[model samples]
Target: MSKIDSAERARALDLVPVSRETAERLDVIVALLEKWQRTINLVAPATLPQLWTRHVADSLQLVPLAGQVTRWVDLGSGGGFPGLVVAAALAEIPAADVTLVESDSRKAAFLREAARVAELPVTVVPARIEQVAAQLAPGVEVVSARALAPLSRLIELAHPFLAKGAVGLFLKGQDVDNELTESAKSWRISSRIAPSLTDRSGRILIVTSAVPLAPIKEAAGNAKGSTHD
Candidate 1:
């Protein structure tokens, strides 16, 4: 098995250079994940040895993709992948905030503790994504999810935040092409996909706009003299 030694891990961390304060906060989160993983399965057992590469580095790659956005909402934040990790980076930005929505009570509790211990600019919302999106305060700049749902459902789930002008940034597996095809069946969306730095089989999906195909078709049909060739 390939292994990443301390030197290698340090070099890997260099790929995304965070402020010293952000690094300290991430350290706290890593410690918490390790402690909690012993009993709660915060991460896959097979990946315990590669925690930094598999989780931390993977999450950190999303920061630059979000540009200058300061407010964020992470859906189904099971172990606070990009949410808490991103929050660590956001700590350096003024007025930054990251809200992590997790439905699992145990996971939510862990997320709360991690944020508290790390002292990150994060809010742990212990509720289903459906229940909290509408209640979210305005001006949220981005919404993200990891290993949560397919592209079609993700659009549905993130609709509230998107409607309010928040961009969507989702971490996805290699099957993303299939998911995007499925989503296109029902929705008209303007989006872009980027390769993931952490894993060859992973992808980053950024969605700026999503509208239902039904309405779009109706609008096209309603336009006077606008006929297909």
Candidate 2:
């Protein structure tokens, strides 16, 4: 990316004041992403060239909605995306901790290294979303995911957090409407779509309601008994 375009991208992201420190960290993030991309395929190859607008800025969009969140859980955290981006931003703010969850060990390693180099207080949890759900603190105030799962499944994975009254924010693409409709089939929830700050074609799903799906073991057992009866 050209120096001119980098400056423009920073301005568009509203990284006010643009401290030398902040600018340096942003550069490091891009460098790490470029290095890791060779092996893990973290982000879309086409999007790598525009990592500023496509990833960093896109992730920072959540910073505005984070109002007073002391702790946050990011699910399916591939290559750190919003999770690490938010962690870096939060360090500038007061009293915020970020946790990144990823099932892939390689991606988790990337998140761990990124968080360490950035000196951001981020916890990397290398586990599947469902397995890690029970360990999340009930007091967490926000949960986020990007391109992780359909809306309904996202809700299911986040049920523990929502049950404790935490809000859910998901980054979705053009199919958001279809995902919302499909989500409604299995869960009753309230949500809204906000225009993405980075991509006009993208939308953020702000969710406030979440209900657990019946356990698979229980649901299957019930089906079998009904059939026998």
Could you say which candidate leads in TM-score?
Answer: 1
Off by over 4 Å in 1: 1-8, 214-229
Compose the digit string of candidate 2's lDDT tens values, residues 1-229. Answer: 4222455566545743344665567667777877877877778776666777777777778877767777998888787777887787777657778998887778889888888887887999987777667679477888888777667667777788888888998888888999888877778778888888878799999988866445522111100000000
* Number of clashing pairs per prediction, in order: 0, 0
TM-score of each: 0.88, 0.85
Tens digits of lDDT, candidate 1, 1-229: 3232344356448877777888888878877877887678676677766767777888898989999988999888877787889998888888998998877788889989998888888888877666678888378999988777667777877887888889998888899888988999998888999998878999999999888776422111111100000
Q: After superposition, how far is residue 221 of candidate 1 from its true place, in Å?
A: 35
Residue pairs with clashing backbones, model 2: none
Q: For model 1, what is the error of residue 229's alpha carbon versus the real structure, in angstroms, after optimal superposition?
A: 48
Give each prediction's root-mean-square deviation over alpha carbons.
9.1, 7.5
Name the candidate that leads on lDDT: 1
